[model samples]
Target chain A: MSAAAAAAGLVLLAAVGACAGVVVGAAYVAFMNALRVPARLAALTYTRHMTRIYEAAMAAGAFLAAVWLVFPYTLRLAPAAAGFVGAAMGVYVGMLASALAETIGVIPVVARRTGLGTWVTRLIWFVVLGKITGSLIYWLYPPLVP
Target chain B: MPTVYLKPRDSLIVAPGEDITLGMLAEFAAEDHELERTLRGQPFLPGLTEGHGAISVSSLDLVRAIRRQRQDLDLRIVGPAHTVVKPRVRPNPVMAGIWTAAVTLLLFFGSLMAIMFFHADVDMPLVHRGVYQLVTGEAAPRPLVLQIPYSIGVGVGVLLFFNSLSRRKPSSDPSPLDVQMHIYDQDAQDYLVSQSAAAHRADQARQK
Candidate 1:
């Protein structure tokens, strides 16, 4: 590909990514609204304005995160602090994944198709354990990652 | 006199042409078998004479009806004072299928795009390389061990967070989605009950 063409392609992908980020952010806010998170947290008068602020903040934060990602940086943290951060990030990502899965009704479809019936819970636990093992191995033994 | 304990529901959906008995309205328990049978069998609404839609029935009305029927029995009412009776309308299978498919597709694509965009924005590969170097004291183009585990962890974490497999929830606490749906259902029922009550008032005013 020519330099100009490659540049154009990159620009297009970035544009698409930006749009996707906006859509995802909006959807997240909507999901939170549907769950009445804000209402539960705040008084009725504050909730309406709070949601608007949240939307704007999320969009700005996404853009900022993207910009920051271009730089190569490393931070040193205490092992305990690192563990805490990792666990927190894991929780956020996990909830997002769960929401996506639940919305799509993935488990029910999979169970029905495989006819796993009563065994599905056990299978889920196995997957969870496998994930924990894999993550432990990755963090503890970094040489294997390369 | 036999004392009966009655717990009324907030809302109920009844099929067309089906009789709304006292059993259908509230759950009641009595020490005496004969009284229990009578209470359960007592008719509330003979059938859907008005055809279909939401109808609000008050517990005060129910208690009065029970008193008239079984003068010898003592009644104890608990919970909501009103119940909304809605007609059970079966949705078209094709329409239901289409709706489900649309939602599933939207959610699936949206989630995928979100993950992809976030990874791209963060320059994840570069971060992975940095992390790899930091951990192993060597630079690598891609960290397959970390990437592979992380990818799997996302899926597993989601499952664990939801604490659900199929229809059954592993934990007693309800998921956020479940709570949201419940709130939505309650809102709908409340709206229907209010509408029905308004209509009843209008009819009463017109009659007067």
Candidate 2:
């Protein structure tokens, strides 16, 4: 492949990845909304189901990596490998986004229900600070896993 | 076919090969005032029975229904028992199927969109590029050897961090996701219990 063609391909991949990320983030929000009723109806079961999905995703990712290592280069497909990785990463990212959304969503309701306005604000800020700290840690450490 | 000894009262024998329902038990113990009243009041809830040296409800559906009503009733079964009751919630199959489909759809689209976004934006070539450069002397377009290891390492790291497949986690190490899920489940249950308790209290107050 020519240098110019390679550069163009790289740019296209980057653009695709960015667009995908936004869509994934949006889907995550939609998922949380969808989950709310089921969760309220059967919290334990719903939570168990979510955990199972996460575990399954993680296992699929590991299995994919194993397959990649065992299989010959001739049989390898970049798109397939990338898709599996992305899906696994998507599940993990979607979960984190959902948790963040839940935290933000629940605080106000909790505060109102309990009338602990000051406590809620303090708790929210504490969580926000913790998230900020985690982001900084991610920048420094760079996730070993996607 | 276990003979459920309604404590301090006579034992009501369940007919063999026939599943004992709350209605059947209530009918059997129609003569006993305390036992009959309790059974009639919550006729759907399963009676708690002792089996395999442990006390457990014979029917989970009954337990689920009974839990909502804050009734002080000691319904225990005694004697040698052969029944092994599994803790299960018998949900409406149609509703369960619908919810399952809904959840599956949500997860599929949610993961797909999120994956596309993250893969395209942050975790694309850049993440690989950095890892490859760190491991190998070459930059930008790193060798296949370096890239492969890094990519595989990403999967391994995720497994290790999540600790999902393993029954035992390394030392006290538990996945943050698992911890969060536990907390969420506990909070929901606590909330439900509190709501039920409050409703029970209100009902009692109204009766008074």
Candidate 3:
């Protein structure tokens, strides 16, 4: 690809990504709700209005996240702060991704469909391990996915 | 002595004036048919005279109420100690609508951001270009052919995956969201029951 073509492709890709982002984000939140994170948080706090607060926080957080993702920048943080941020992001992403699977009753449905009733626990461990491995590969060697 | 095995429910919704019987509050199995029938029929709470909200009842309370009538009964209480009795009332339409709208908007924006972030992170445009070039053996500045179909596919894929197309669902199967909501409801109810149980324990300790 020529230099001009590559630049144009990047721009076009950004446009497509933005559109795809909206759909994915909405679906992610919808699935997150299925996981009942907001509900559980509200119940834990013993506040009826906590759900609204949680939703608002999520919306604002997501907006900030989008901004961070789109604008290429490097932040120098203390190791502790970096660790905390990484842990928080990991938790949020993990829960959101798992929500899609759990909400759809993936384990139960897969077990029933495959007639692996006895291996339900094993299947769960497999999913967990599989996710960890895939994530490790993606982060460790991004070229694999690309 | 009748052995009554009591498994307390997490929550029960009742009408304002409805009588709450032992059977409605908990699942109890007893050896003696006559005693079981009598215990099940026993009034736990006198028809709510005034209140129209939740009233937590503990297993201890149930056992006490049962023992009041039959001192010779042996009660084995299993599961959570409390049951939250809520009034069955239709929610206000306006409030419900507002809540729904707020949630819908929030989720839409949040998910959109997440997807965009992932795309930007991976440099998806470059990926697309690579795939397009590999397939066609030509460098197209704007791969509308591949991009357009892929974009449309994303939306359709979401609809199918979520099992919802607007309001008219394509299938009778419960959507993932529906299943999650159910699970959340169950979790919330369990939390409430446990909370009530803890409160009951604290109250008893204070009384002693």
Best by TM-score: 1
The fraction of reference interface contacts (C-alpha pairs within 8 A across chains A and B) present in each candidate is: 0.11, 0.00, 0.01
Interface RMSD of each: 8.8, 14.2, 16.6
TM-score of every candidate: 0.53, 0.31, 0.51
TM-score of 1: 0.53
DockQ of 1: 0.08
Model 3: residue B99 alpha-carbon error in angstroms = 3.4
Instruction: Give the Cα-based TM-score of candidate 3 against the true structure.
Output: 0.51
Please name the candidate that would achieve the greatest lDDT relative to the true structure.
1
Q: For residue A31, give model 1's deviation from the true position in Å.
A: 16
- Give each prediction's DockQ, rounded to 2 decimals: 0.08, 0.03, 0.03
Candidates 1 and 2: which is better by TM-score?
Answer: 1
Tens-digit lDDT string for candidate 1 (B29-106): 889877777888899886664447678898877899898877887888888878988777666678556655554444
Docking class of 1: incorrect
Clashing pairs in 1: none
**What TM-score quantifies how close candidate 2 is to the native fold?**
0.31
Runs of candidate 2 with Cα error greater than 4 angstroms are A1-146, B1-88, B91-113, B130-135, B142-146, B167-181, B204-208
- CA lDDT, candidate 2, residue A121: 31
Ranking by lDDT: 1, 3, 2
- Writing each residue's lDDT as its tens digit, candidate 2 over B25-123 gives 333233347755555455542443332121122333343444456344444444222222222233466865564454444434443344345445675
